[model samples]
Target: MSKSKPTPPPATPTPREAVSNAKLEELDQNREDSHGQFLTTNQGVRINDDHNSLKAGERGPTLLEDFIFREKMTHFDHERIPERIVHARGVAAHGYFEAYDNNASLTRAAFLQPGVKTPVFARFSTVAGSRGSTDLARDTRGFSVKFYTEEGVYDLVGNNMPVFHIQDAAKFPDLVHAVKPEPHNEIPQATAAHDTFWDFISVTPEAMHIIMWLMSDRALPRSLRMMEGFGVHTFRLIDAAGKSRFVKFHWKPLLGVHGVAWEEAQQVSGKDPDFHRRDLWNSIEMGAYPEWELGVQVVEEEDEFKFDFDLLDPTKLIPEDLVPVQPLGKMVLNRNVDNYFAETEQVAFHPGHVVPGIDFSNDPLLQGRLFSYTDTQLKRLGGPNFHEIPINRSLCPMHNGQRDGHMRQAINKGQTSYSPNLLNDNFPKQAKQAEGGFVSHPERIEAHKVRARSKSFVDHYSQARLFWNSQTEVEQMHMVKALRFEIGHVLQESIRSRMLILLSQVSEDLAARVAEGLGLAVPSAEGVQINLNVGADTDPAPYQSGPAKADTGRDSALSMAVTAKANAGKESIKTRHVAILATDGADLEAIADLMKALMDQGAQTAIVATHLGSIKGENGQQMLVNGTFQSTASVLYDAVYVAGGAASVAKLKQDADAVRFVNEAYRHCKPIAASAAGIELLKAAAYPGATDILDAEGVVTSDDAQVGELAKKFMAAMAQHRFWDRELKAMPA
Candidate 1:
């Protein structure tokens, strides 16, 4: 009867609805327009058949006269750019770095001033993987951050591990080539467990330090947010008075360093190729921003040589016991990238991108990176003017005489483009030292011109031994298993034999365990030419580089068990996933109370079941299932809970998938709990008989009266993250 039309409902947000929409508005252009519009050509012409191209006739060759077909085909053909040479697979985030105190005492860089927040674009990547490779590849992780400071972009390019595989930059290409897939057939996509890698590393003992780290749990990160980042090179921090201190940069994660089991990492690669990306995106959407504290091991210039190993050595690390890490600032990644390709892929980072007070050291590997990063970006991003890209643009003012190149965004209008000109009154002139000019630290370097590396860099195995001696028994066992897994994959017998001999140089026990896994005897190192002083034909005996000093004390920082101490006392489990396993006839009240307590502590609870959609509850309440057992697995959740109701428990116990879910979670050492009759499900899963799991370790099983207390006890266990000691008891998943 009424001619007036009903008002249209408010437009819904994007798929990631809970994200910071206010920040999204800052990105200019057609996000809103594209959302409600129909598909169109690049020129905005409406298109109907995007699924099929125009042809001469049905199933015939297309004609060049069809503008829509040609445009679509051309765009798709050039859609991809050259992927990165090393860090090909990656994810990025936008964030800000805030200085905790005035680090003016160490560096005069304005970004390090107290309370200054500098915009940052950080990229986390797996080195040596193709763009389409799985994120869980067992390889080095590249952790690079670009701080868009007032002076310039200061990039702290580093890795998850503190050390590197080579001492000199000259050996970098060779190292990458060796670890990459075989030259004959690119067989392995993203792995180092091959013959060529072992063959090259057998003689290059300088890699021993990094080898230990690679085989350890650090290489397999649990989450990008939980990984530790290290500036692998020793850098210099210059003060106002021109005094310099050798500093080792470190990123101490707020969540603490932790990693998934190797078996679980493999499982994740198959179940969810985008597990890490999804985790980070979901965490940010839930308002749980990842955080890390920036710290530095500041060594006085006078004390640089006090340690046995050279501080400038890329393959070595200064133990935390010698110099404690001082927290200078903190970095919080609060936003995900708007465009993956434009921001995460095109953003280039280099060690040379520094401001006033931060300067480079003589680390050979770092020296090479200074030039390689710029060169690679030129080819991959298509030009030198890539800085004009929004994500890579500096937040502060930028003025320079640099003119147009490929893909240039700025149009300069002047008579003169070169410096030292008077026509434009020397416009865009350089700043003086006091006027925020960037001046490299004037370190004295008078030396003979020769193609020779410093002999001080020769001591590699000392720190390698230090790393081995520092690991806990659990970590050490993981390394042993990892080594066996890798060496077993090698096709050549000599490579495996050489590996056994080389590993003996680290530890006899380690060598023996790995040898047993390969079903071979421990090979003798008598004929091995370890390092040989970089092929100079020097005496191989002295070049062996065994522990320089056996009395070196263990460093707690080397172990995740010690580094994760902070996580053990954290108040909440924000962003942690908890799976609520239930079936038809599940108790409605008990499940609701448990979810409330967990949600109050910031843990996300998802109701997982034998099937999707809704499940019938005992109280006539319908429960919305988040996912089904066919879709969700134990590895996806931080913890698991079995809801009560006699019928629900009986049904779950009879279901093999449900039994396996509980058993697998137990096998992975994750915290598990049950309420009332739900304990029967755990018993049906064949839980190990150690103590009454009701209160033993992280497994909590309570009857009806104690259901209220179960939530409290469960959250506390989840905060600790993992119940690692449960690994002592074996169970079949």
Candidate 2:
């Protein structure tokens, strides 16, 4: 076997469309700039008047000869098409993926080569929700991207989580059915905190590892701009020399991974159902584009079995400790979709849509997705011609004999469409590997057809324990609370009892803490029988999980707080939304100094007050308010800053909404800063007692309103994301 080092792969013709910023220019050509253009009909005919359609008279009925109205109305009437079955609710943005260095050594994928800029359309979604569902649901976030590379549109479809619930594709439908609203009532929507879901989790041993992740804080992403995405299954990267190495793909946000508290997520969902959608759109429109670095963990073919767990198992991870992730490139989303229906809703992503160097692994889950994605698009997009959609169309010229689908856009002029024909001079012949044609990695395989899983997949609990041991104390406590909240919603007592036993297999402490919240004792594992009646005819006893090994140690990367706490500089606060609470008679100097510093660091600030328009300072300075008490909430911002003004603070003290804003920010563990008279507001908020008010963990206060020391201290606290150490003493807002 070849060693797992960067080596030149077999040569293939360089693609014509593989030039830097080619997609950006291509997209710009299609962009319409209405600044100096006249209003026109669909056929580009200029219209003298748009407000009123052609009619017999000023008050007469509109005539059928008015084709413009008819065309406009017809298109508007059919604007909406079918949403995706799984990832129905989603938001997408246009960006370019830039390679850091020539990766021709690891893989001959043109987009991975040095300095190549591949245009990309990334769609973030919440699975198990309808097109109108809230973005804050506790479900897996879909992180699918369509990379318009020279070879083709290579789609790297994945999720925010690295692991999945089921190990095989065959169980995908069953898993979805269990997690979705129940067939009888269809009661709960976009959540896994119901009986049917817990029932499935209680019995499926393969779901244990994913359950640990689902119950963690990762599910509650603070912002789409700050979440980490994973390609989940093991894939293959082929060198030009035809050598292949198993690889896992990762997307690390430059802003650092962060998440909101569960309580805050739920409240935000009610207040603004489009929280994530609005956040992403606003950030991009503000020119604060979201960015994520593409990374990979590569393993040699010979070393695939070196790990205790099977690399082919979709429910497992290679643990960053075992194989470190190497950053290869960066993807920045800079543009929003022009039309939601034409682009965001219609883009089809497939794992099968790969470039020359990237190929598929025999991972059961990946194999299933390869087939499912195309089938889904065919049905949902109204035909096999879904790829003809502008968003899905590849930048590279496509010439295939396949034609005439339900919605054929390209009008073929040639009479002869067959191959090796004299009529059309045998046009569009297939190119070889030397001429830019895709060549799959040649791996020798000798295997018998079987329906059984590999024996290596049977050890399911060890890594689960490793993940359990990896979390920080704050994260672990959050997991316990999540389990309690989720399992407590299960109406059936037996389901709750079995889940505790399974949790015990991972950790007694975990099960014991969750059980205490449910007012139940931990069930004995010896007497428990694993349910294997999931439409399968097999012996259930063999599948009953044994206790995890004691050697299952920690993988520090599993903890979000640990990783986030380490990220420094402007990236930590880039595009962070901060709310500055102030009123009339506030010190304009303090507010101006604070806002200027925050904006200079790339953090967005909003002046929030009891009313909109402008508020007057004591020094006769006028300040504009971005939002009013009725328009905004604390859940919308990352941190809160109170500007000093004796008269301003005195008036704000009378308003219940202003007091509640500071209180809620503190309860959420967000950084709170105040200065001079602004200190009165912090005192009126949380833990309002004895000692010093200026020295709290994340609280920054100053008597001087110039904001010199206060700004620096506040910036440092905001970088921390959350003050988890204050969780124990935090009172309700």
* Candidate 1 lDDT, 1-733, residue by residue in tens: 8799888856986656636575566564444555767667789887643322333222122233556544554443233368876888999888899997758899888889889998888899999778888888888899999999988788999999999988755456657778878867987889998888888788788898899999998988888988999999999999877789999999988877778778878888998978888888888877889999999999999997798888877899989988899999999999998888878877888787888889888775676566556666676788888778877777778777788899998777767878888888887888888998878777665443333455677776677778888887777888988999999998888888888876777777889999999999987777556543322333345445554455556898898866665458863687789999998989978888899888987789999988888999987889899998889888888899999999888989888989999888877778899988998888877555644455446898788734678888788888777766555555411
Say what the RMSD of model 2 is: 20.4
**What 10-residue stretch in candidate 1 is worst by lDDT?**
51-60
Estimate every model's Cα lDDT from 0 to 1: 0.79, 0.83
Clashing pairs in 1: none
Tens-place lDDT per residue, model 2, 539-616, is 455456566888888887899877867664444577888999998999988899888998988999999998899999
Best by lDDT: 2
Alpha carbon deviation, residue 218, candidate 2 (Å): 0.5
- TM-scores of all candidate predictions against the true structure: 0.86, 0.87
Q: State the number of backbone clashes in model 1.
A: 0
